[model samples]
Target: EDKLSQEEKQSRANHLMEVQEQISYDLNQEKIGKTFKVLIDKKEGGHFVGRTEFDSVEVDNEVLIDASKFYCRVGDFVQVKISEATEFDLYGEVV
Candidate 1:
């Protein structure tokens, strides 16, 4: 049996992490067009940032379509419909 070198092990670990992240992102895509109750934790870059009970994914409060119709502050629970998702975050609108 041959053992992997340190560099090879580190490279394999990094690749695994990337694969896992991609899998997670792919799974998160299923949340699109779904509504969830998200708790606003904070605001970032003029957008509210929050997480839901589902996997604790980041729910971005800024909706590219008609964002002016809703307003929420931190510590608020809002019903948000998942509109778009990235590798690590979810974007939605209040419903």
Candidate 2:
């Protein structure tokens, strides 16, 4: 019997992660280009950070909006048109 090498194990793990990421992306593709209501949470760097109903308040996905597009304060609810989606974040513009 032959034993698997460390490199082989690492390669397999990386491949599995890639496959999982692709699956997640496919599942979320429907959200792209859709408008969603998001609660403005706070400002981070130069962008405003917020999340939608599909996200958790503390530890889930977040949406990034351009701070220059509109005037919004923390705790405000605004409608956004989602323009991009990744494995863990969404980018949008004010609707």
Q: Pick by TM-score: which candidate is best?
A: 1
Angstrom error at residue 72, model 2:
1.7
Candidate 2 local distance difference test against the native? 0.86
lDDT of 2 by residue, 10-92 (tens): 99999998998887677567789999999999999878999997788777778889888766799999998988888777889
Please give, for residues 1-95, the per-residue lDDT of candidate 1 as tens digits. 76999899999999998998888689778889999888777766657777885544433223222235567788888888988987777888888
List TM-scores for all candidates, in order.
0.79, 0.74
TM-score of candidate 2 versus the correct structure, residues matched by position? 0.74
In Å, residue 72's CA in model 1 sits off its true spot by 1.0
Give per-residue lDDT, candidate 1, residue 47: 73
Best by lDDT: 2
Model 1 ranges off by over 4 Å: 56-69
